[model samples]
Target: MIEEIRIDNLGVITRAHVELGPGLTVLTGETGAGKTMVLTALSLLLGGKADPATVRRGAASAAVEGRVLLPGDAPAVARAAEAGAELDDDGSLLLVRTVGAGSDGVAGRSRAYVGGRSVPQAVLADLAEALVTVHGQADQARLRSPAHQREALDAFVGEAHRDTLARYRAAWAERARVVEELDDLVARTQERAREAELLRLGLAEVERVDPQPGEDVALAEEADRLSHAEDLRAAASGAHEALAGEADASGDALAATEVVDRAKRLLEQAGGHDQALAALATRVAEAGYLLADVAAELSSYMEDLQADPLRLEAVQQRRAALAQLTRSYGSDVAQVLAWAEDAGRRLLDLDGGDQRLDDLRARVHELDEAVAALAADLTQGRTEAASRLAAAVSAELSGLAMAGAELQVTVEPAEPGPYGADRVEMLLVPHAGAPARPLGKGASGGELSRVMLAIEVTLATAPDSGAARPGTFVFDEVDAGVGGRAAIEVGRRLADVARSAQVLVVTHLAQVAAFADRHLVVTKSTADGVDVVTESDVRLVTDEARVRELARMLSGQDDSEAARTHAAELLELSTVGR
Candidate 1:
């Protein structure tokens, strides 16, 4: 049950808050009084498309929020729970949607919260659909849809054929899976051949080079030394000559070593004369020993300075090959190796082509057989269900004052589809002698509305529909083209339907309005260059007020004594029923 709905800046309804209760709630007013705005608000909140023109003149955005109370064990509650939304102890849910203004608009945002935890818009819609079904003239037209017709018929049959339906769906799904696989395999066969060849070529190229990770760095280092070998040897020889002081080279005092050694000897001779001079002699002797070690090391380095051309050539060639392989395959040897392994796997799969082809053929054959079996089962189920559904709907039509009307659920064979092979249509014969035709083609607006009502009443009690707690059913102008006893019957039947489900009727008929559990009066007022629509709950209408409102509905704006009397009598009679 929907607890309440609050609308803001939506159409002519600037700000209206409606508190809804159980049973039939009727909204009544003059035709142009903007009663449709209430239904528009509910529609937008239920994932309906938003049109910017529907927003009020001065409002920046339009928003609709609703509080829906559900049974604790309702299917909707389970769906919400599965979506990870929290549930209150009372099982009440909140749904809110706001559409921002502008052409580049962020249109229609929906949020569902249960016990204050956020959930997806889809979850909210699932819950909303379970709790309330809006049967606008437009939605009722959807009953003519093939899918909905099939569902309605199935629902009417209850669980007698449920297993057959389940088996059919499973088989159909498996067949679809096989068909998709077969198509994919056929499409990729040529591509796979090309891929195999490319991989084989790449693998051979990489293996020929045999590039090792980090081998590039070693080769580059060796190449650098080889490239500058002559210069390195020259520098080494010059350093050796300077340090060791060879013949014909600069030999200081003879060499730096001989000069320090002579200084040490002189200091040693003068040690008795000056102790500070003795310390200087020891420092000079240490300097001479350090110079001698430097000279010996430089000579050994010069001896090892010659570069081998063969090793340098090898390093250069190896580096060039590695660089070429890197360009062809990957930036590094590790990546190249990974690519090789993947290619090998793909090659094996492609090479064993005959076996895979055989497997695919076998799978396709099996799926074909399964699909046929499921189709047969589904057809049988529909065939059996159609007879019972036709009889039930036909019975409902008689109560709606269409005694000679023939209602038939015609199930015909069709090519196998996701929904199986049963094509269901509601065929109708308006008169006893008339040929049956599709309900949409045969029924007028008034007839269509009654047919939809009959279908709803039938499905409500059907076990397969799984609607244990029926949703709020809305009827938009179902009283159109109906009057007299038929009008009263419409009101009575709608009231009867309300006992099990919340029903909202947008009506101008006083007969229908009189039967309402709650009555809302919509009035339009123009204030400050803006249209404003207001709704007041008139469920507790005084005797005089009922006379005036019903009189206005029956005889326009006039409030004559006769109209008032008639209105009073209708209200009194409705009260007596209560």
Candidate 2:
């Protein structure tokens, strides 16, 4: 519950502080006395839109602050903490909003704070959604919206419908996901088939050639050797003839092996006289052995060397085939092999497109059934709740001086949506035998106000069953066109609602004002000059002062003896059943 509200430089309020407590707290004053400004200040603190035009004349800014005491486990308390707002020692939260006007034609700036910590205005708004619900003429206008009507019906249904709604929403979300996947697969059927075909062709080509790693380089080297086979054989034969005697050469062409053998024999003959000569002879013998080994290798090489054009052509053709694969798939045989491996895996996936599509379609069908079932449950719950809620509100209306009037809550099947497969609407049956019509179209402004009040009272008085209710309920001009016993009933119902929560009403009716546990009067004071700014002051009025205020509201004359007596009697009647 909001403990207090402070307003400064707001409208004609200038500066005002109002203390609010449990039960019905009524604000009364003459027209244009800034009574509505109190609600506007509360709206600002609740993160409502800020209008610079509301700033008091000659003031640069307007500010509103509220102190709210909440239970430790209240939803708003946790929400405020989540936004980094601190709770006071007494577990009260402070909410502040400031709207500042810029110089002359500049736009205004608005800021919001919670528990002395600056936060986004939206954070304050979210917290306020769970803390207070303000009803005024504008809210009555909202009753015409189908969405709002559905929301009201759902809220009236309480936990059972909420549970079914949650389940329906979950099923609907999954169904949407499955449908999306199915659609995507269906749309890509032709594309996936084409991709698979391309992959198949590429993989078939790679399999036919069957290129090996490093095969391209090895083939190139072999081709070069084969192309120069005759030249290489001729060079090896010449070297062999120089190292060992040629078969058709003259004897004077001494071979390297014979020369080194002769040197070794001469050195051995001299070795008997010196050890150094013996070592020189061993070196010459090693040289003769190396020469002989070279001669043998050259002879074998000439025999093995050959020039086969057919084989060379085969190598060239094979190389051209590998090059083609490389051009289309990769830079070389190794890269082409890598591409083939990857494409093979991708081909598997693309080829299974039909199977995946079948699976998704089957899943979508199952989810659709689940969602339909849940939607049916939700619709049934809402239909039942709507009937009960309508009866309850209708009963409330009968007590508010509309005994013959009835509220009809209609729940009809609608196309499946995120919410459910039901459309809820509120209709008003003004009197006996009157045809039921939509609220705004069938009810007068005064009737609409009463209807809204009735609905609020019914909902507030209903058993909570553990659901959180907004701590504060504000009604601005809720008694707009109500009078006599009807106005008194409105006040009495507001007080009834207040028994469970805090309620504040801005009213002009003396009957309603007289029922308040606390009465505040907003009075305007004019300066000496007619053009001077008018100031509005809000103060608690009690005892004779409160009686005089009620008298002015009753007859426009606070000093009238008859009006005073009537005011006193009305006050006395308001407390008759307390």
Candidate 3:
């Protein structure tokens, strides 16, 4: 519930502080005394659009602030906490809206704050759900929208209907997923076939060549040795001749082994005469043995070296085959083998495309049937609920000073959407002979206000209202076209609603003001040598002062004995059971 609201520099209201409490609170004033401006301030606090024209003339800006108290576990409380808003010391949330006066004739920008923390206007709008329900001239346009009408009907239809809506939404979402996958498979059929064919050709070529991981490197080594075979043989044979004289060489090349043998024989002969000579003789013998072993290895190497043209040609051919594979697929045989492994896997998936497509198509068909069934059920439920809602709202209109007014809620077939396959429209029939017309058409503005009020009251008091009732309700000119007994009944209904929630009304009827638990009167003056509407112009009237105000409202003459007498009697009737 709203604890208080302050409006500054908005319309003719320079500054005004309105303290609200539970039960019926009424504000009565002369025309253009800033009564609607107070409601406008409430709208701003609820995240309504900010028009620069609403700002007071010559004022730099306009502001509206509200203090709302909510339960600790309320949804708005949690939302405000998420936005980093802090509760006040007394546990009330502060909401603020500021509209900057635009420069150079441009419209001003608006900013919203919750619990002293800045937030998007959307957050303020969300918070409004738990705070209050407001009805004004603006809502006449709202009643014309089909979407809004559907929402109002749905709210009255209760929780089971909402659960049905949830199920329909889920079914629709599933169908969309299936359709998307099915479309992808159908659209890419030719593309998948082409990809699989290319992969098959590449894999076939790779299998035929059968290259090993390091075959290219090993083959290159063999090719180099084969090309230089003659040079290698010559070098080995020369080393053999130096180590041990070549058996077939005609030149006089003394063998290294023979020279070593001669040195060992001479050392051994002198070894008995000198111990040092014996050690030298042993080393010379070991050197001759080592030289003989090296000569044998050199001989074996020369004999084994060979240059065969056929083997060399075979190696060159194998290398060329491996090179072809590497050119198209990789830098080498190892990389080529890796490419083949990936292509083989990808080819398997593409080969199964037809089977996957069959499965996806079957799934899509199943979901399409399911979604259509759910949409039908939703339409049927809405049709039944529509009838009940129409009767209820029509009954409410009868008591709102429109004896024969009837509200008709219609649900008709529409193209299936995320919501459902039904279009909801609320129509009004003003009198017995009148034809039913859409809510926004063929009705006076005052009648429209009453019609909406009836719908709202019905929804709020309905056993299955879909959600909790808001803690506060604001009505602007709900009694605009009502008077006498009808005005009294309007006040009584408002008072009844206020029994469970806070009710604030802006009205000019004396009977309505008489029912208020608290009364405020907005007045304008040309004091200070200028016409101004300010906080001082707003005064809470009580006791004899309230009687005087009511009298003024009754006959435009507060001092008249008859007017005061009637005003006192009205107040008495309203307070009788208190």
Candidate 4:
């Protein structure tokens, strides 16, 4: 239920506050009384497209705000919470839309807010849809939509099969998913084969190299040893020749170790004269032992220095293999190992048989059966509810001076569609003697309005209609093509709906105006400019004023005594219902 609506600087409505309450609250005024403006303002609040031209002449912006009391567990609350909005315990959601302020043109400058948080226009639209359902002359035509048909049928069935519908939907989704996967696989079967071959080739190439961690570093060291073998051999030979005895010697053939040994012996004899000299002689002897060991090792290395061509070839080959692996797989040995592991996993998936394919096919078949079953169940419920729905709508049509007008709900399977197997169409027979036809086929504008009202009245009385409907419902010129008793009945119907929901009606019918809970007369007032004012100026209308307004509607005159008396009688009757 919408608690209130406030419109500011919008079209002919400079400022107006509509205190809305549960049930039918009617708005009626003279021609161009801003009644339509009220509905337009509501449409804007519900996320309708914004136009700058709708702003009042002197105002920079137009704004509409509403308070919607929704169900505590409504899906909207979860969405609001996800958007980081706070919800009151009473389940009231505040919505506000402001358009074309200073420096803010149409486009990104326009803004909407929910629960005190600024939100995108799209979010506001979604929130509005979740809370309120607006039905205009155009909206009533939407009852023909297949989705709406299914929903209405489901609502009429009540809670008995809600869970069944849920199950059906879940099954349908799964079936759709598997079918999609099957299509993808069929499209890519050849590509998968090529991919498998490519993967196999890559794995074989990597395996042949058999790269190991730290192997690259060790191979490089060995390659260096083999590359410099000739130079190393020559250097060792020269050192050995100098340390050991050579075939020809220039001054003396004594090794340096012999000279150090001689000094050690002389120092041992002179130890008593200088202790420091004896210690120095001991260090020289240790140096002689180290020198002798290196000299012997050099001699052995020289003996073993034959450059084997085979060994060099092997070292170069191993180094080349490591280089190739590094270039293809990674910057280092570790990365190549990681690539190999990943490739192995992909290979397993590719080579595995059609187990997944078979599973998908079976699951799709299973879901199709479930969907058919649910569609059948839905069809059954609609069949049962349609007769009652028809009777209820026909009864409403009778009051609108359309007695004998027949209403029918036709449910049948549509082409296999996203909403599943059902299509529904509403039919009408406007004349008592004529055959029933689709509502669009047999009804005139006034007839359509009455038929639409009848249908709406029927749906409203359904247990779930209130829960499923948008918060506000607007009827634009529903009383346009009817008069006399018919006009009075239209007024009564509008009043009746207001008792269950917020209703705004635009009309030129005095009978309709008389039924309004709050009657506002929109009139053009010329001060500095022509300003549109509500009946607010004529507050507490005397019998004379009431007659004047009714007379204007009835006879196009502002003053008529007879019209005044009739208007007062109608008002008295409407008030008595209160």
TM-score of each: 0.79, 0.77, 0.73, 0.81
1 versus 2: better lDDT goes to: 2
Judging by TM-score, tell me the better candidate of 3 and 4. Answer: 4
* lDDT of candidate 3 over 69-132, digit per residue (tens): 8888788899899888999887799999999888798889899999889999988888997788
lDDT of 4 by residue, 385-433 (tens): 7787777778888878888887878877776554557677678888688
TM-score for predicted model 4 compared with the true structure: 0.81
lDDT per residue as tens, model 2, 367-466: 8888889888878878878888899889999989998999999888899899988888899998989999999587888898899998888777887422
Q: Can you give the lDDT of residue 506 in candidate 3?
A: 94
Off by over 4 Å in 3: 7-15, 27-41, 47-64, 97-113, 116-118, 206-352, 376-380, 410-415, 433-442, 464-467, 477-488, 507-514, 521-537, 544-578
Ranking by lDDT: 2, 3, 1, 4
lDDT of each: 0.75, 0.87, 0.86, 0.72
lDDT of residue 427 for candidate 2: 95
- Model 4: CA > 4 A from native: 68-94, 101-108, 144-147, 161-163, 234-306, 319-336, 463-472, 527-548, 573-578
Worst 10 residues of 1 by lDDT: 534-543
Worst 10 residues of 2 by lDDT: 527-536
